[model samples]
Target: MAKSFQNFSILTSIVTLSVLMFSQGMLDTAHAEEYDFVAGIHNEVTFHFRNGIETVNFPVFSTTSDIVSNIGSSFEVEGVVGNNPYLHKALDEAYLYRMSTLSGGNSFEYNYRYFDVDVNIVQNENVLKSFKYDNCEISGYSVSTLTDDYESYLASDTGFAIVNNIQFRCGGVGINLDSDKSSLNSESRSFTDYGPLPFKLAEDVRTFLTFEFDHGSEKIESVIFTLTSGFSEANDAGPSFQIITAVLPHPLIDNAIDKSQKVSGMASTFNEDFDVSVEFTNSQETLRGLDFQDCIVSGYDILTLRDKEEGYTGKRGFATAEILDVTCSGLAPVNPAFDKLSDAKESRSSQMSNTYTTNSYNMGTGPHVIATFDFDSGTEVVDFPEFYQGNMIARANPTFTLVGVPGSTPLLYHVVDNTQGSGPKSTGVSSNVELFDVNLVLAYGNDVVRGFDYTKCRVVDYIVRTEHDADESFYKGFALTDEFYFECQGYEPFNPKYDELFETSHAKTESSSSWKEKQRDAWGPGFR
Candidate 1:
C-alpha cells in the first residue's frame, strides 16, 4: 500500500478582516461583507469547516482558486463541481473566517471541501472520507455557477444526509479485536448538527463510541478507552469521562480451530459483538483441505500465518509424529531400526513400524510391546514401552512337568466328577475340573498398533475354577480311585520332592519301629 497518510498544513497568508479591505478601484462594485472569508455560504446550504481557531467560509465572489491549496492537499473538493479543472477553479473565490474555540484546545485539525458530491474532511486522527446530503435535492451547481444558482441549490432542500466510510487507524498492541482481521475502523458522522454533520464547530464530538480493541495485537487480555470530551485539563465543565472495556474470555490454545473471544458484556466497540474466531485446527486432514502449504508451526494465535501462505485466509493446523517401545523377556533381537514389523517374525523390529504388521499378537502372554506418542512438536523418543497392545515371539510349544503334591490342589486337567467316577462303567477318571495357565511367546502382526487407542486383543491364559456350580457331584464325594500318573503325552516327570503324605493313616505297630522304612516306598526319603 502506498503512503496515503499525511497532515495538511495551513498557509499563513490567508487573513480575515473585520472591515472590508478591497481595492479602491473595486470599492464601487457591491457589499464589503462579501469579502469576509469566514462567513458561511447561506445561499445554498450553509457550510463552514474548522482548522483549530479558524473557520473556513464559502467563496463570496466565485472567482478565487488558491484557498483550498492553502488549507490542505487538493482532491476535487466538494464545493467545486465538474471533471473539467478550469470550470471548477472559478468557485474558489470564496473566503474563510477565523472562529473562536467553542470547545477544547486546538487539539484537532478539521478541513473540508466538496469532493465528488460529498464533503471530504480531515478530523484529527480520523479522515472523513465522504459526507453527503441526500435530502437536499440540489443539483447542477458548480464553483463557477454556485454563486449564481446558490439559491437554486437551496430551493429544493430536505432535512437528511449520510456520512460514509470515515476511515481511521487505532494502531498498537491491545488495539485489535478478538478473531480480528483488519486494523482500520470505519465510523460514521451523520446529520446530527441540524444539518449533514460538521456544519459548525460546537457540534463535533465522538461519544459513547466503542473503545473495545486496540491495534497490532490479538492476545490482549483486555482493552479500555475513556471518552472524556468536555474535560480537557483546561476545562473542568468539559465532558465527563465515559469508560468502555472489553476483555478476552479464554486464552488462545494451540491448533484449535474456529476460536473467538466474547465481549465481557452486551455492549462493545466492534461492529459485531464477536469477531471471526481464530480459524485453526490440529487435524491433519483439515490442514490439508486448507492451503496446507501455510500450516503454522505449533502454538500461535489463529491470526498467525505462514510466509509462503501469506495470502491464504483459511484456518491452520499442526503436524504429528509417534513412537512405540517394546520390552520383552523372551524376544528374538532388539531391532529399534527395523522398519517392517513383519521382519520381527521371531523378534521385535527396531524401526517403529505399525503394530498391526507384527508376526502374531498376544495379550498378557509372553513378550508384550508398549508404545509412546510424540504429538505436535515431535521432540520425544522413548526408552521403555508403555502403550501398545500386541504379543511377542519366543519358545512356541512350552513344556510343562507333571508332579503331584500330597496335599496342595494341583492344576488338574480333565478332572472327573464324583458321580461319573463312581459308576462301574467309568474306566479312567479324567473329565470335568481343570486349571491350565496358557502362557505362550507370540510375535507382532505389525510394528505399530492401529486406531485411536491400542486395540489389545491377545489370547492369554484362562484358569478355569468353580466360579459357578449348580450340582454337588461335580466336585465332591469320589468312590473308587487308583494311582494314576497324569501328564501331557510327550512331557517328562518334573521329579519334585515332597515333605509329607496327605490322608494315609498307619497303625501304631507300623509307626513304632520301621515307619520310616515302610513310608519311604510311597514318598521315598521324604517320609520323615
Candidate 2:
C-alpha cells in the first residue's frame, strides 16, 4: 500500500507543476497586452473647498502667486485621482502658494465638508497624462451619527453587512488646508484621517513628464510643470492645475543673453554678394607668363533712311543685302609661303596666218599651163584661263621695296570671287565682283588671326590677276590677261634704320611714288 501511495503522490506533483507553468505563461501574455501609464516627476498641489449645499460654488486655491501671473488667474476643476501626491511634492520644492476668492466678490469665503475626490497624476507639463482612481464608497452622512447612520443604512443587510458597509463608506475621509500666514488672515484648517488615506499611487510617474531647456536668458538646464487635483462636497471630483519652475545650470545667465544677441547681430550682417579686386604693381612682368586664346568676330550692320536721318542714334535700322567685312589684324608676322592651288590646266591652241607670194614662181610656166603652189602656216598659243592653270604664272618672288630700307618676305594675299561666274576671276577684273580677301599676317605663339582692331594694326592694299578670252570670235581659243598691285604702311617697322633722317626721307619718297602710280593706273589717260 505504501509503495502505491508514493507512485500516486509523484504523479500528482508533476501535474501540479505543469498547471503552475501554464498559469505563469497566461499571466505573462496578459501583462504584455496591458497599456503603459506613467506619472510626471514635477507636479503642482491644489486645494478644493466644499460645503454641504449642493447649489453653491466651491472655492479654489494655489500655493504660488507666480502661477496666477504666468498662466492666468482663473482656476478650473476636474475629476481624477493619484495626481495630488505629485503636485504636493512640486509645490513643497518650489515654495509657492495662492489664496482662493469667492465668485463675483473680492472677499474670501471659507467652507468645509467631507467629500469624495479623484486626482490625476500628470507626467509632464502637458495636460494629458495617465491616471488611476481609488476604490471606495462614500455617502452623504453626518459624522456625529456614525453608528446610528450605519445601523439605519444596514437595516436591510443580510449578515455582518452593517459593519462592513460603514467601514467601507466612511473609512477614508480627509481635509487639507494652507498654513502659510502671509497670505491668510486666520489660521488654516487641518486634516484628520486614520493613518494615510487609501489613495492609489502611480508606480512609474516619471516617464510622462518632459524637461525643456531655455538657452537664452535663463540658460536653464530644464523646465518642469506638475498638475494635480482634489474634490469638493458641492461638486463631483475634478482635474488638477499645474505649477512650473526652471532649473538653471549656473549663475552666468547674463553671458548667455549677450551671446544670444551677438549671434543675432551676426546673422543680420551676412550678405549674399561681395566684390573683390586686385591691382598689379608691375603690369608687364605680371602679364609675361599669361596666355590668351584667339577669338574671331564676323557680322554685318546697316544704316537705314531713318537711322541716317536720326544722325548717329546708335541703332541699326532696315538693311538691304548688308555686306559683312571680316578683317584679321594685330597678327604677328608669319613666313610668306604658298599653301595650295585650285583649278586644273588644259592645253589650248589657235591658228594665225601671214601670206607672201613669189612673183617669178609662175613666170617659167610652159604651154600656157601655170601651176600655183599654196603654202599654209600656223602658230600655237598655249592658252590657260583657269585660276590654277600650269601656263598661269605663280607669284613665287614678291618684292617689298620701302625706300632705302631693305624689305622682308612680303605678305601673301589672295582674292576669291565667291560670286557666280564662268571661271575664276580677280577683283581687279571687275568693279562689281564680290570677293573675300585672305591674308597671312603675323601671329604670336599658336593664336590664329582675327577681326581688326584699329589701335593695333591696319591693311593698306591688295593685288590680284585675272585671265579671259582675248577675242570675242574665238573666246575659247585665245587668252586675255589682267594683273593687280597693292601697297600698305602702318606702325613702326620691325627693322629700325641706322640713319633716321635718311630712312624718313626715303620712306616719304617711296610712299609718294607708290601713291602716284596707283592713281595713274586708276584714272590715267591709258585707262580712258
Candidate 3:
C-alpha cells in the first residue's frame, strides 16, 4: 500500500517573514495520477523511499494506473507512523485556509506536470541522486496500457508509474496560524516530519516514513496522481527554514502500540518551575520580604478548563491535573494532584467577583518588585492537557505582594495579610491597574479529598474584567472577587494574563468529600 499527499514546495512571503516547504528528491510535485485497470489483476512494484537517510521498502500493488493507491490490499503501507485518512483531509482544509489569505486568492494557482524518473550522479557525494522531477505537461495524460482484455497478456507496469504530485501554490500572502491544527489525539495517530513526499527525508532531519504490506486477493481499485511539484515567487527577509509535519492515521490493531501523542501551546513566558512572574514598576524597593513563613497553598489534584478571554468559562473538569514544584517567591516546592471534577457548582476563578470587600491600608515605603517566568514548551504543557484524560501538574507556585503608595485606588494591598476572616471566603485587595490578589494556602493537613485543599493557596493573578483604552487605568474599577478561587485552566497554561493571578481550578474537581470517599482517594490511586 502507498500513502498520498499534495501541495509540495509551497512558498509565501510578507513584509519581514517568509515561510515555505523545501525538499529535494524523486518527489518534486505530482497530482493524483489516475489509472484504470482491466479489473481483477494486481500490479506489484517495489515502492522504496528514504526513511531517515535509510531506505525503507514499501512493496505495493495497483489494479490501475491511478495515483491514489487503494490502501490495505495487495499490500498495506506500513510506517513507524500509522495511516490516518482524516489527517490528510484536515491538513488539506488547513492548506486551503492558509491559501485563502482572505483577499490574496487570485495569486494562487495549481500547475500539473508528468515526469519520467530523473537521476543525477553524486560525483562528490558518492551514490546516485536519482529522483522524479517534472519533465512534461500532463493535461490529458492517460495510463491505460498493456491490454484491457484480461484474456490477453496482463497489464501491470502502468500501475507502478502513477504517483501523485499535486502542488498548491501561494504567493504575496501571509497565512501562518495554528488554529487549523486537528483536534484528533496524537495517541491514535503518529506525527512524521512530512516533506513533499510521505516517504522521503532531508539531510539532517531524522524523521521519515517506512512501509509494509499485507498480501491479499483483493486488488487496489483506483490510483489518481493529480499535479507535479513546483513552488515559486518566494522571497524571504533573510535565510529561512520550514518543517512540514504530518499526522498520519492508524489502522485498527488487536493489541496496538503507541499511536497517540500531543503537543502543548503554553506561552513562552513561564519559568521552569511553572510560576507566573511579572514585571511591574512602582515607588518602593523590597516590597514584601520573607512572606512564605505564613504563606499557605491549598492542595488539589484536578485540572480546570479556562476560557481564553478574561471573564467567561472555557471548560471545567475537562481532565485530571497535578501541580508540582510549587514555589512562590522562590520558596520550597509543594506537589499536589487533583481529580477531574465536574463543572457544576461555581468554578469560575474571578478577581472582580472574588475580591469581595477591600479596606484601605498603609504599608510604609519600600522598593519596586519585578519578576518573570519562562513559558514551558508545548511538549511540556501537552503532557497532561485536560483534553487528554490524564493528570496535570504545575511545576511551582511563587508568592508575591502588590504594595501601593498613598492615593492609589484601594490605598494599600497585600496578597495574604490584606484578607480578613478565614476559610474559602477570605478577601484580599490591590489597587494597581495590573495587580491581582495573591493567596498562600498553607499545606498542613491541607490535602482535601476530591481535589479541594484547605491549605492556604496563593492568589496568582488579577482578573481584570473591564475593558478600557491605553490611557484608562484598570484600577478605576479594580476589585477582586474574593478567595473563593474556582477551578479553571486555559488552553495556554502559561498565558501572561493568568500569570500571578488567583486560580481556583480545583474547586469543581471534587467538592466536600465524605469519610469513605476520603479513605479511598485522599491519598488516592498512586499512593502505596
Candidate 4:
C-alpha cells in the first residue's frame, strides 16, 4: 500500500487561515456572535495519537468518495481513487482498534486509516447531538469499474473519485444527546474543525449520519456520526470528550458442507458464554458425513480473516473455528482385545520349495480347540480316580522302598521283612463344603462366544498343565490342559447351559475389576 500525502497543500492552507483567524481573536472564545458551527463539504479526518497525528482527505473535486464515522466507534473512509494501489492491507491495521485506548503510538508503518472522532449534529445553525467514535480501522476496501459505463461516467458528475473506499472495524461509541444547554455536553461542545467552512454543510444532518454495521440482518438501535469537529480548546471549551465502544460482527460459520450441523449462539471471544459440545458439533460440519459421537473438545482456534475482495461488502472480518482432538472419552468395548483390534489387517506371504504359498495375517485367528477333562478324589470332589483305566494311583502308605540308580546303571531296593496290623480302620463322615458362584468364559479371537456359570461349586483342586509328545498328530507336539475338581454343596450337581453367565454376579464382579485395572493403566496408577 502506498501513502499519498496529496492533501498537504490543502492542510497548509487551512492551518494558515486558522492561525490568521486566531491572531484576530476570532477563534478564541465560545458563544461568540462570529462563531460558526456549519460543516464544510471538503472535510478531512485526522487521527490523533499520543505521539503524533496523521490526516487524510478527499480531493477537492471528488464527489463519489465519502467518509463514514460510527460515533463512539470508527471511521471507514474510501481512499483516493486511482489505478496505483488500494488499502486492502493487513489485519494488523484493523485489529489495532482492539486496544482500550483509541491511540496506537507509531507501532505500525502503514496507516490503514482508522481513527476515532467526534461528530456534532447541527440543525438550524445550532448543535443538537454529539457523538464520539474511538479506536478505529479501515475494515474494508474495494476497487471496481466497467468499460461500458465510461460513456455514462464521462457524462456523470466527477473523476478520480473511485479510490479509497474502505470499511472500518472500530471501538466503543459514546454519545451526548444533551438537548438542554444547562450542561457542558450541549451540541456547542469543542470539535476539531477541518476543511473550508461556511463552518457547516447545507445538507440535512441525517444525511451525514450513515453507518453500516457488520451484524447480519439485525436491527440497528442507534446512530453514531464521526467528523473532525469539536469545541475549540482556545475558546475555553477544549475538544469534547465522549466514551466509545467496539462493535464486532456476529460470529459466523461459512463454507460448511452440512448446513444442518451449523448451529448458532457460539461465542466469538472467551468473554462470551459457550458450550464445548455444541461448538464441536457445529465445527464438525465443516466436512460432510463426518460425525464423532464420542469425541470431545480439547482446544479451539479462532481465525479472523479480513475482507479484501472487491464487490464484497458484508462483514469486514470473519472468524472460523478449527477443531483439535483430545482423548477424553471413557468408553471401552466389551472385551479388552476389542480395544486393541483394528478394522483392517496387515499380511505377508512366503513360498515353499513346493511352490505352495503361505500367507500370514495380522488379524487374530479364531479359537480352534477345546479340551475336556475329568478327575475324582475321595472327599466329596468325585467318587474315585479312574481305577479301571490302568491309571497309576498313590495310596496313603507303602512298606517296600526303592533307591534310584547312579550314572544310569543300577537300582537298589530295601525289602520289608515284617508287617503289623493292630485293628480295623476307622471311617469318618464327610462334611459338605460351601459353594460360591463361578464363571468360565470361552472366546475366539477377540469375541466371547460362550460362558458357563456354576452357581453352586466348591473348587476342590485345579491343575493347568502343558504336555509334549513326539507322536502327536498336530503340527506342534505340545498340548495345553486344564482340570478342575469341584464339589456341589446341594444334593445334586446340574450343569448350567452355555451363555447363562452373561448377567451373573460373578461376571459383573470380574468386569468391574477389569474396568478398574484398565482405567489405572490408561491414566495413571492413582486412577481408580
- How far does residue 459 in candidate 4 sit from its true spot (Å)? 89
After superposition of all CA atoms, the RMSD between model 3 and the true structure is 30.6
Off by over 4 Å in 4: 1-44, 54-75, 79-115, 120-128, 143-148, 153-160, 178-528
Residue-by-residue lDDT tens digits, candidate 2, 386-452:
1111111344322121110001111111121111111223322333332222122222223323211
lDDT of 2: 0.21
Write candidate 3's Cα lDDT for 1-528 as tens digits.
122222222222331122111122122122111211111111111111221111221111111111111111111111111122222332344355554534554354332111222222122233211222222212121122222245223433211122222222211111111222342223333323223222211111121111111211111100111001011011111111111111112221100111110001224422221121111112232121111111111111111111111111111101111111112222211111111111211364322111212222222342111111111100001000001112335543323323222112121223222321112222342232122322222111222111111122333322211121211111121211111111222211232234436654554455556655777665856873
Model 1: which ten-residue window has the lowest total lDDT? 317-326
Q: Which prediction has more favorable lDDT, 1 or 2?
A: 2
lDDT of each: 0.20, 0.21, 0.20, 0.26
TM-score of 4: 0.21
RMSD of every candidate to native, in Å, equals 35.6, 46.8, 30.6, 36.3
Error of 3 at 408 (Å): 10
- In model 2, state the lDDT of residue 293: 16
Encode model 1's per-residue lDDT on 21-129: one tens digit a residue: 2211112222222321111111111222221111121111110111111121111212222122222221231112113212322442223322222222222323212
Name the candidate that leads on lDDT: 4
lDDT of 4 by residue, 436-474 (tens): 443333444335465333344333322222232211111
Choose 2 or 4, whichever is better by lDDT: 4
